[model samples]
Target: MEALLGIDLGTTGVKAAIFAAVDGRPLASAFVDYPLFHPRPGWAEQNPADWWQATLKAIRSCLEQGARVGVQPSAVRGIGLSGQMHGIVLLDEAAQVIRPCIIWADQRSEPQCRWMTGQVGAARLIELVSNPALPGFSAPKILWVREHEPELFARVRTVLLPKDYIRYRLTGRMAMEISDAAGTCLLNVAEGNWSSAVLEAIGLDPALLPPVVPADAVAGTITEEVAALTGLLAGTPVAGGGADNACGAVGNGVVRPGLALVSIGTSGVVLAHAEAPHVDRSGPTPRIHTFNHAVPRAWYLMGVTQGAGLSLRWVRDYLGLPERALERWTDLDAYELLTREAEGAPPGCAGLLFLPYLQGERTPHLDAYARGGWIGLTAAHDRRHLIRAVLEGVAFSLKDCFTIITAQGLQLEQVRATGGGAKSPLWRQIIADILGVELAVTNASEGPAFGAALLAGVAAGLYPSVEAACEATVRVVENTAPRPELVTLYARFYEQYRALYPALRTVFHALAGLS
Candidate 1:
């Protein structure tokens, strides 16, 4: 059987998976973790070399596992990539790394964001890119570097996003796909190409950015050297994959309109597929992002919650001493123990709410200075209450995105849940009740990796098109319907959750200054 390989370069790790091209059956998979560096507060950076090495390890391990399962490396016909979006990796003329990559979590570009808003009026800026200029985007990072590190900026020859950099390493070519390019804030999202106007407004040359193509297009082939390193056949085609969220949508069979995807990984996102670009230019603050989809001639409306699973992770590491002890005793994962404890607590956690702004917020608020904490905490609140409140808070945050999506007149017929948090039934029910929508868990495992492999299949001619691939490979595995009583309860609490951010806005800014 022919096999396709997918590689995901995530914020925390590199994952590689092999899937049968015909029906998307998973054959083998491997993951290798990497460290995220915080050289200073509000800054996140990673070495391109580290990503390359980790990817090599992951690919070799995946191939070995496939071999053990009777799938040969030679059977892998195509490769695709998915990765963390909006990271800027600079290279000199010789394609040598100019500096460590400034990643999606970095917040050092607020001033540049403000400057861009001033140069090209906020409304015009949104008109050009279909979203507001934010600190985490590539355009602001480019401005930040040009102003702060002019000498280094002068030496820069090419700019690539996180996964595209890996593509360069594997194929010896520098190119980017539309879905990932849309996040760069340099792309004309509606047109599915780089915006020369935005580049000119920021005094950046168009030559610095790589060419953009559709996600399923063949980017390049695996070179002999990379093939040797990963035990893959030379001349294997590599498809231009997508931004993680876009690929995740494809993996979950969210290729058409009316199907929404809620992803809860290190961050949270609510996305809906759009047949045409739906730009919300009426709002003074554009809360939703409209980006080119991985599916050809389509778009997606997305709202992001910067801290989703990260909140649960924080509770697990910092406040789950009992759960940790139990984990050692019972061999249960700390998250499992924590969620089990939380399941005992009543929904809404007796009026306690969490903001989940530990890494700041994106949808609705767009404040980089936002802070996260538990509100309405009293002596009556225990660890169970805290854990349940965190889960409920993330669901509420996603509900914020759902509100924006519906406001745009996009009907959400089905909501598919994908990511680490979606594995928990309790959390899935919470999200369903909070959003007032039925939730589904698809048969597709490995989310973005699976989508990448499907794209690889299309590029390799194993599938006629993206829709055909999804029709053949993706299926709904489970469903969770909203409970009316819980939905009413969550509706009341969601209002309370919404009020906390505005009330604490000034205080959060003040605390950020003090720090």
Candidate 2:
């Protein structure tokens, strides 16, 4: 039996999973964690060396597991790569990493964003790149390095996205797939190529960027060195895989129009697939993002919430000491215990609300200075209310994305839920009620890794197309329907939640200034 391998290079770790090439059933998986460096405030960096080491360990471990099930390294037909988007990886002439990667969550490029807006104008930037010049994008991060660390920038011979760098390490080739390239703000998203105008405007050389390939196409073959290092066959085809969100969409079968994906990881994302390129040019900055989809000739509109699972993690780390202690003796997870406690709280948390801007706000409000807190708390409320309010607050922020997508006239037919938070029945129900839509959970709980495996299957000729591959392998296993009463309650509470951010904007900025 043939098998496929998928590697997901996430923010905090690397996950490698193997799946049957015939069907999408997961065979074996392994994960290896790595550290994220924060040298200064609002900055996030990761060493590419760490990612490579983790990827190697994960692949070896996963292959060992696959071996127990009668699947060998030689049986692996293809490999796919996916990772966090919009990160800049600089490489020197000798293929050495020049600096630590400035990842997606880093916020040090606001000045670069402003400069891009001034150089290209906001509306034209959208027209050129199909999105605003956000601090998280590759172009702005490149500019930040150019302005702040010119000596290092001058020695940069190539720029790559996170996964593309991994691809190079595996294949000994330097090329980027279109789905990840679209997030760079250097790609003309509509035309599906690097934007010369944007590059020239930013005083960047086009040669620094790698050639763009289709997500399902074979990017290159695994080199003999990587094969020996990771226990894979030399010359195994590597698919030009996607960004994490795009791969997540594919994994959950959100390929066609009217289908959406709601993923709640460290960050939350609501993405709607579009058959045509849809640019939101209504304001100075587009409320969300429009990028090339993993599927050829398609696009997706994405809205990001900087903190989703992150908000729940804050509760787990700071307030759930009892749950953590219980976890040592019990099989239950700490997050599960916390969500169960939240079940005791009534809907709306007794008028208490939380702003899940622990990492600042994204989506409709693009403010990096926004802060997180519980508002309308009363002496009568307890810890249950605080926990429940955090969950509700995250759902409300996601609803903000859902609202904007629907406002653009895309009638969503089905919304697939995927991520850590979606595993909680209470949290899933809360999101359904908050968004007034049923959430379907698919069997591909492996998320982007599963999607990457399917893409690998396509590259290996196991499937005719991306949609065909998903149709054969992906299926909805369960649904979470919204409670009518809770939906009505959330509608009223959502309006109040909507008001909190605007009212607190000035104070949030003031606090940021003081900091």
Candidate 3:
């Protein structure tokens, strides 16, 4: 009858899951979508209140479903939070939201990132923390507010990451977990707390940040006000969980060193779970990120591709609108419909390469202004060719990241794959062939939400340890291997795909009209 609940505040939605303390199998789960706001061309923001409301709705739905499945709402003992990383949430002295939570994908703080790198010295910064500057990181966003909204900056009291903000609402506690703080670019990763040096250079008071804690530790209990609003017990324990990605890695059982995961969500990422810190100081500008593992004192290395599924979504919603009229003729899904016709697309899209940078790019490019395109489109080809090229281009970009991960000394024997895009057999096959790694896909797609519930089980004394939770719960459903012929074909095409970015790098910037 015992159960633990996990709530994940994701970029696209919020998910709540209830898991049995006995075996860690998820008993029931629910998710609800919320709106995203883009005030300017490059700015992406969300209301903190909306995230809290969406989380509560998702949790209530889960509690209802759990009761239907024989686990009553009161059986939910301990709860943990998993949320998107690098978001800046500020509160005044009275603990009121001072601004919209600057989300992880927003690119409005490029100048702040450059300034921090210059002031802190990038090498010293990386040595102090495990990662380098990204425009979306929390510290850079904080600096952005100071430089742009100075009046509001003067009133700031406490700064919180996305899940930290949620936890603040739930338990009236200002605290953060190490894995979430790692993405903030303000944490001393080795010390597992805020870096005073970075704080001083950035001109922010160290006291403004929350006290850091380990992911498994309990931060506080739910307040009476939250209990009345959420319909849960007033004294329910709230654990500090990691960011969505780290918790997702935990959810998928990538707790031990040597295991890697391929997540093709709105953005794409290839992460390897490492026991010790993994840093490559020598080459490649070192954009690969490292964060403390959600599993007690562990670490992980990850490579990212920013324009994975979004590119396909863009193409389908924009360029392929005519293809839907084509959709009425067949039962195939848009991807299947496109893939069938596009596979007929010759290798390299018959010289039609796409950059896949619809929303800028990350990993190899790291260029926010990096625009996307079809290099050689013609009247001879139609929509399917363009659509397939986007998919292949995304796969090729992911391979570029995987190549870096391999360079950093992580062996790639197998990869555990998850996410919405992972459902497509063709995309999965394409990634397997392009990366040249055997890929295993799991059945449960709840990802970090499921992983958060597992952590809850650990906290509630349901499992001896986090390892035992994954060992008992996570299972692989299918293993995909690269076709020999397609692998050989992609090897040649990948070389060309890698070079295309640099060749057009100047042109991408020029077309920006930035000058």
Candidate 4:
């Protein structure tokens, strides 16, 4: 039996999983965690060499798992690569990594986003590219490099996303997939190619970007060096994978209409698969993006929140976590311990509300200077109340995405929740309560890696199409439906949660000492 392999180079880690193509289920998986570098405030980067190291380490671990269980490495017919989006990787004439990649969460390029909005005009930019400007996107980062790091910018010959750089290491290939390219804001989303006009406006050359390919197209084979380290055969085909968000949708079988996906990571996002590009020029529900999906010729509409798990992390590490109590009460499980405490609090967090926009916000507001804080905090509040507010605040943020999508006439019947945050039952329930929709949990929780394996199945001819691969392989463990009473309570609380930002908008930037 032929097995498929998938590699996902995510924000914090690299993971690889193997699945049986005949049944479309994962057989074994391996992972390696890495560190994120924040050399300066609002800047995030990862070394390309570190990613390749993790990728190979993960693949070797997966191979060892297979061997321990008596599966042969040569039985792996194809591999696929998936990764985080909107990162910038530069290569010179020799194809060496130019510098550490500027990741998706870096906010250093805000000035560039604002300048582009002024130069091109928001209306014309949206008309051309189908979304508003985002600081972490590829175009602004490219322009920033030119302005601040002109020496490095001039040395660029080709550019790739985070995972594409890994593909380059694997097969001596230099290419970008459409879905990942779309996140760069350099792609003509509707036409499905790099936009020369936008490149010119930004003073970036089209040649700086790599050639774009379909998400499932063959990228390259494992070179002999990689094969030797990985204990795998040479010339193993590697399929062009996808951006993490698009691949997460693939992992959950969100290929058809009326289905949407909600994810909570460092950032929050709501993505809906569309048959074509859908643009809404004017509404409270503004879209930051419509991008090519991992599925060939398909597009996805997305609403992104600047902060998601970041809120939880802030609450856990910097705020009111009762550390000693959690070690004893919840087996050192921070999320469960927090949720158990939250479950004790009444809905609305006892009138304590949080905006969860420590990094400003996306979705309806689009205010980069938006601030987050606990409202109604008093002597009566405690750890449990504060923790509950954190969950509710993040839920309210995700609901902003749902509101935007539904306002555009796409009624989401269901949402499959993924990411590290999705593992918490209390967190998923909070989201369902806020959105009033059923949340499904996928059997394989490794979203991007599993989806990359599904792409491998397609490339190997074991599955005829992406939909077919999903039907053959993917499985949902169960559904998370909102309780009627909780939903009712959250509905009222959500209304107030929506207003916190507007009321405190100016004070956020003021507190930060920004004009």
Ranking by lDDT: 2, 1, 4, 3
What local lDDT does model 2 show for residue 236? Answer: 98
Candidate 1: residue pairs that collide: none
Predicted candidate 3 versus true structure: per-residue lDDT over 130-221, tens digit per residue? 77788768898999999999999999999999888998888988998889998898988776778899888878899888898878767878
Report how far off residue 454 is in candidate 4 (Å). Answer: 0.7
Off by over 4 Å in 4: 320-332
> What are the RMSDs of all candidates, in order?
1.3, 1.4, 2.2, 1.9
Summing lDDT over every window of 10 consecutive residues in candidate 3, give the lowest-scoring window. 320-329
Query: How much is the lDDT of residue 150 in candidate 3?
Result: 97
Off by over 4 Å in 3: 282-284, 320-347, 513-515
Each model's TM-score, in the order given?
A: 0.98, 0.98, 0.94, 0.95
Best by lDDT: 2
lDDT of 2 by residue, 1-515 (tens): 89999999998799999998777889999989999888876788999999999999999999999999999998999999999999999999998999999999888888899999889988788889998888778899999999999999999999999999999999999999999999998999999999999998989999999899999989999999998898999999999999999999999999999899999988999999999888765666788889999999999999999889989988997886464447664777788888888898999999999999987777889877788999998999998899999999999999999988878888889999998899999999999999999999999878899999889889989899999999999999999999999899999999999999989899998998887
Which residue pairs come into collision in candidate 2? none
| Model 4: per-residue Cα lDDT at residue 80 | 85
Candidate 1 lDDT over 163-213, as tens digits, reads: 999988999888999999999888998888888888888788999988997
Cα lDDT over the full model 2:
0.92
Which pairs in model 3 have colliding backbones?
251-451
* CA lDDT of each prediction against the hidden true structure: 0.91, 0.92, 0.81, 0.82
